[model samples]
Target: MISGALGAAIVATLAILYGRALFTPPSEIDGEPLVAGAARVLYVIDGDTLQIEQQQPTGVVRRRVRLIGIDTPELGRTDAPLKAATADQPFAREAAELLRQLTAEREVRLELDRRRRDRYGRSLAYLYVDKRLVQEELLRRGLAVVDAFPGDSASMAKRLEIAEQDARKHQRGQWQKQ
Candidate 1:
């Protein structure tokens, strides 16, 4: 059996490591913040994904950005037969529509986390529009659930969790009883 002292020390070490990895602020390079630039949202692909035209020092670049700390229902997939669901997932359209209304053609700031890209090569970020956090809004409306990854922002995850709880308590959007 593991000793109590050793287990406590191990847990403490793990917590410290996790906190550093997930809560570290965005880095600065040459006295400028790395993700300080703003991007115009070309389109919202879904509730949590967007295509953006970002203005960089070199030129304008278009990229797909996946929102951090939240997940909405998936839209229908006709292209992939493996996950073959012809119909959209529950509340998918509502989520997508709300996202579109929130960000379409608007300038949004992308705040990046430690893991900058997902496996699919989409930029991972916390999207903000006019200083409003889109993820928190979605969670508050019950349109999304907290789906933070290990390297995503810990503070953001906490905020999202609270929003989701409030949504559930009031039975808003997808949380409404059928």
Candidate 2:
């Protein structure tokens, strides 16, 4: 058993080391229902995900945001913990390249849904660059497919679905006949 003096010393050290984290309030995004703001894109993680930096009172906060209502071809995964590695899908590179070219180090407008974040903790948002929805561009180019969820905006989902259908009909990008 620790002496009273030793136990007090240990507690004091822990409090000094971790007090801020234990007492500071959570960020606004953690509790907000909807988040609408502009952020600078730090990098494109994939066709439908990006890292962005937003200004916060404490400092700049970097976050990963996943686009809503769309899914792009998967990039190859060489490092899997519990499953076999997988190869890139047919249009994976093209999709990722397109997204990178469009959003890298650029300012983007973010409009989040009522369900601000997904199960992965990445913000779910619709990103816009120069007033054009990036998701629609991906769909029109056949780089991504409509992947609407219950949380997605109904009208936007419909629009994305139409864009995807048109791309498919025109045999664009990933929809090209093999």
Candidate 3:
């Protein structure tokens, strides 16, 4: 009985440790800054997020970044016809492509939100390309909808609300008639 209990505890401990390592962000990477200028867009994860490649002293580091205050419909989400039509491709791919068109290879500034990285270890940042808020631009273009997770509790909800309202009013993207 004692051996069984000890073995169970050891297994549980290993599982937890592995999970933490998988989910937690790295303490430091070559190009990551607590706060820094926006680098070039390497790729977009979704309409509301992207991966940026920045040059650091050591080398280039690709950082996954989520746009503040926006969420777009999943590629195959129930309500989005376009997304559903392209079921073979992941939902985020379209958004990423659009983002690439908008900001790939362009220099932009980056601002940190309340949190630096999300549970998935992606950076949470507000991007500004040529003085434009990348998040707001995505909203204006109807590429993404507003989304605020629990980690963004400190953010100003009003911005996301307004973005959603505008997208609805304009019938942008999935909001438009199929």
The predictions' CA RMSDs to the true structure, in order, are: 14.0, 5.0, 7.5
User: Residue by residue across 1-178, what tens digits does model 1's lDDT show?
Assistant: 8899999999999999878767642221122223545889888898899877776675556677888888999888788767755888888899999989988777888888898777886777898989889999999999999998886678888989999999999999899999
Q: Rank order by TM-score, top first?
A: 2, 1, 3
User: Candidate 1 — which pairs collide?
Assistant: none
User: What TM-score fits each model?
Assistant: 0.76, 0.78, 0.63
Pick the winner on lDDT between candidates 1 and 3.
1
List residue ranges in candidate 3 displaced over 4 A. Answer: 1-34, 56-60, 75-94, 149-156
- Global lDDT of each candidate: 0.82, 0.83, 0.68
Residue 23, candidate 3: how far off, in angstroms? Answer: 20
What is the C-alpha lDDT profile of model 3 across 1-178, one tens digit per residue? Answer: 4698899999999999888767644433332563577488766656766777766675566677877667765544355666544452333555656777778778978877677776677777888889877777667666677777666644455666677678779887556666
Candidate ordering by lDDT (highest first): 2, 1, 3
Q: Give the TM-score of candidate 2.
A: 0.78
Instruction: Give the distance in Å from residue 34's predicted Cα in candidate 3 to where it truly belongs.
Output: 4.6
What local lDDT does model 1 show for residue 47?
A: 87
Off by over 4 Å in 1: 1-34, 81-85
Give the per-residue lDDT digits (tens) of candidate 2, residues 67-87.
988999998888889988899
